[model samples]
Target: MTGEEFQNRLNAAFVFEGANYGRVHLIHGTQDAYSQEVLQFSGHLALSDAFKAVFLEAVELMNTYCRPRVKAPLSEHYPQFLARLANAFHTLCGAECAAIRGYPRPAFTTLRNVFDDVVLVSASLQKVTDFYKIEGIDPNGKFDPAAAKKARKDEEFKVRKLMTGSDSGLSADVTSELSKLNDLFDFEVHGGRLSLTDAMAFMKGTGPLHVLPKFVPQTFAVFMNRFTEVGWAVHRLVPAIQPPGVSMPKEWADRWTLVDESFEIAVRSLSNELGMKVGDAYAEFIKVKFPFNAGAVFPL
Candidate 1:
């Protein structure tokens, strides 16, 4: 199923499956209680459609990568990465849908979680790729038992340092984008900053004279930003791990192009909304559209 179609299935599953339903329950028709409860997530129909369309393609590529015919399986840690990535996608889709339904406070939380998942993609990169590791840690020279164990525990699944430093696993632009995202929401992620209640308070603003967020395009951008970066990494990592006798698939080539296009479309949308110019490198990769039939994209 396409990402959009999958989203619809998830929504339907909820009504039939009850609490076991794993999809966003977005209602249709005119502005009603369910939709009015949340803000409309995006008014940029073309951009929104583009994001979902490419995300579907990325999902297909991931499934293909998981079942390789020639090489050994992807890294042992890859399943963890996929689990988180899929969850992030689910959260992202849910958050955007929620915003369209009018519940943006939860979308804030979801956006923060999405950033954490993107960071995971960076940490898992070295594990999944075919690159050799030269251990910088002194395996034999260690002294303290408890301290060593604690240190090892602490070091698990950490890629922020490597990403920010010299490993260069992620492109410099992606690294920079993540750094900015981290800085922007550091307190929020740590539970020091805004809560859904606090966001509601902001919306409620000063005893009935309320202020509202630019919910539509802004919420869409938040969702797109998180998915595009990590999606690009996970999508691109497949080809980077080909074994010696294994040939790359034409599917990957097409998927790679689609992934890049998706990422570019997202970045360009951000730029346009922010009134900034698209960078030259990404400018070259820009496409007019990643077309899809919206009517058929989701069967609900």
Candidate 2:
């Protein structure tokens, strides 16, 4: 199906799903809204039908990625798990694009934030899964050994290189999760050195890579900014709609309590993850030293 057709189907399916159950459960509706926003934001370029298909595929991708293993159960901490998945997609996309484009180390703060987000989500999921297993939930069908191993290996490789600075030709200042990959390997895959233009073209194509549209750092940031806004809105609306005795997770509860105090910390964390100081000097450097010509692309 075309992109538009896919998107329409996705929208319809989600709307139906939401309408059918959302009115009864504030959590369900809020979650649905979050998912729908992600779908819409990521697939904005596609035709509606195609976008829906792609969105479904993305969800399936998440399921596949998080499928349970023989030894461990899948986590029931839905929000944290979803957040991690989102951050992972974003990090991978940015790294791939930078590798392809030969961009001089995009900020590391975003990538670090992605890593931290994933770690938190993964930990929360693990906790939930463990809790369920101990409580006699069906534990056999929740873990995927191979996928888990791959994820661990990928993360290990990334973290090691980022922390140790082993790769040559990578900038010494490139310390963020996003910049770390540059040191580990040359962006020579898919024939010649990968460029951002080529990466964008490849991402706009098909399959798992289709998610690349959502993962690429520049676009991903825009999407994330939107997600944060939506999340804040949902958080605000939740109290009004929530039924009595619906207990929120401790982490979320804590976040709400310290939301004001955490804003600056969050900004700093993001800055470190992207590897750029959020000061005016850096902004000036980009404007004066690295002025973009007509065709030159600025990275996210």
Candidate 3:
């Protein structure tokens, strides 16, 4: 092959068709930039669809509860806190979509972004820092790095400090989880030697490097688990914004219980019966495991 032909072939998008013949198909001369094939591969998975449904339901709950109509005469800080919480939920959904599409790196990075967004919401609630103050700008409406630098110097504004410090309002379990997740996601996002080597290892024996989406059930499972946890974290913020001793309305709370129970069953089913079809048996597992009647009213 000529030099141009060799380079063109080298840069083409290739996917391993099967392990039996070790065939790599170059479906197109250019890259599969949109990950169309990847999505197609993922679309057939029952567990993946369940994960998507769970996340969508969580986002729906957020839309239902985290709004002005839920509580009239909102507190002064409620708007800012809810805004940051909304951002976290938005990024959480983005991470879910990225993972569902078989883009693990983007999903990992965006999960870290979700954590940071949640931290900021917590910080605002704890009164460690004001959102507007940190976002302050010059009169011209342009960024002021100097002022930003000063804001960064504040001990209260440091992520680790805000998460772990005595004044941080987060519970011990939450503080520890956030701290651990931050490190884990940061390591993956930085794409260091270890991270790159690990990625390559995952693709080993699968022909050439996979530039397109891969249908890795294990990785998708992990994403679903993490998204479920993060969704709960987002939900917790709603009650945090309420008045002392105030909780979400019983109707909304009951609805959330249903979603949470369904999600847990889905995750457990995926774990116990990995590679099993998500059909009647899957629905049966949920019914059997949930300990509630389908026709019964929501449990008090």
TM-score of each candidate structure, all chains considered together: 0.50, 0.21, 0.55
What is residue 53's positional error in candidate 2, in angstroms?
A: 14
| Residue 209 Cα positional deviation in candidate 3, in Å, after optimal superposition | 0.9
Q: Which stretches of candidate 2 lie over 4 Å from their true place?
A: 1-58, 61-76, 107-109, 128-300
Candidate 1 ranges with C-alpha deviation above 4 Å: 1-68, 71-75, 127-153, 156-158, 165-180, 190-252, 268-300
> Whole-model lDDT, candidate 1?
0.46
Which regions of candidate 3 fall more than 4 Å away from where they truly are? 1-73, 133-145, 152-159, 165-179, 192-195, 198-207, 240-249, 257-300
Q: Give the per-residue Cα lDDT of candidate 3 at 157.
A: 52
Worst 10 residues of 1 by lDDT: 291-300
Let me know the TM-score candidate 2 reaches against the reference structure: 0.21
Q: What is the C-alpha lDDT of each candidate?
A: 0.46, 0.35, 0.51
TM-score, candidate number 1: 0.50
lDDT of 1 by residue, 192-212 (tens): 353443456456674432233
Candidate 3 lDDT (Cα, whole model)?
0.51
**Model 2 lowest lDDT segment of ten:** 291-300
RMSD of each: 11.9, 23.7, 11.1
- The better-scoring model by TM-score among 2 and 3 is 3
